[model samples]
Target: MRLLVIMSLFALSLVAARPDASKYPSRYDTVDLDMIVNNKKVLESYLKCVLDEGKCTPEGKELKAHIKEALETYCAKCTEPQKEGTRFVIGHLVKNEKEWWRKLSDKYDPERKYVTKYEAELKSIS
Candidate 1:
């Protein structure tokens, strides 16, 4: 019984620590871009996961569309502070991904497909 209770607590803690992807509101019309920008990891992971999934699966395509639209909307309404915070997070992603793409571009697309695809959008906030 004690062991069961401890394990339950551990499970709950793990779940609590995980980022909330659902925080990106379901209705795009209702999305609070600032919230997503503040919790940038969720948005970053959504973007990178879609890329990591290689643009083939239906789920990947859906996520790509959602994140792309969300980003577009965010860019339109973002204030300087929001853009600053978001740029900081996205810049980190760009740095890491750029290095990966450079190292593997010949084996990948040689055109730096992922970096090229996201770099402009990500840097637009800067």
Candidate 2:
């Protein structure tokens, strides 16, 4: 009887250990290097046009806001520094997508293939 009770408790604990699937985005499973790269490219293009122009017109402001929103939506799991790195990339891309996006952005971008790559590395240390 004691063995049975212990077994039951172990099973219960295992059940509780499972992650809550509904809380995470469905895209979590599909995320890959290509998706991140594509998103980054698009984000860079959008921001470069807006910030460098400095007009701050309604349309430019709206584009900046949309880029920020998109970053938050897609990279929600990223850390503060990773997010900041992403912003830096966006800013550089806005300034010079072809020339300095890779150079001026941050070391993190070149070091990793995907945005999550940086996150994974950071999490490993912690």
Candidate 3:
């Protein structure tokens, strides 16, 4: 009986730690991804912000706050448009900004685990 209770507690802990597919904040979802991607300086600034090499704007800070979790959950909490925007931004980076992408991977995916976990949905855009 004690063993059963311990197992049940462990299971519950695992479930609790797992992020659910709830909505992330919608405020920044409206940010102009096209402008960011097209403007080399703007995109580099965001990369530096995430890598902790430069100052972060409010949006950059928000992005930094959520990046690890978003990667861990494959953006499970992102809204539909947020997911699409993620694909758009990432596709642009992989295609055009290999060096920045490498820096981002080193910081956020140091274990080399989560960056490539994009699966087919992100692949379709790339």
lDDT of 1 by residue, 1-126 (tens): 000000000000111111445332222222233343345464433334444533323322333333333343443333233333334434544454444233322333355443353358656755
Judge candidate 2 at residue 31 and give its lDDT: 19
Q: How many clashing pairs does model 2 include? A: 1
lDDT of 2 by residue, 17-75 (tens): 11553222222122131232347653333334433533433323433333322333444
**TM-scores, all models, native as reference:** 0.29, 0.25, 0.76
lDDT by candidate, in order shown: 0.31, 0.29, 0.54
Q: Give candidate 1's whole-model lDDT.
A: 0.31
Candidate 2 lDDT trough over 10 residues, lowest sum: 1-10
Q: What is the lDDT of candidate 2?
A: 0.29
Residue by residue across 1-126, what tens digits does model 3's lDDT show?
A: 000000000000111122343655566555667777778887767776667788977666666666766766666666665666776676666567767666666666678676666534447744
Query: Of models 2 and 3, which has the larger lDDT?
Result: 3
Off by over 4 Å in 2: 1-49, 75-96, 100-126
The window of 10 residues in a row where model 3 has the poorest summed lDDT is: 1-10
Question: Which prediction has more favorable TM-score, 1 or 3?
Answer: 3
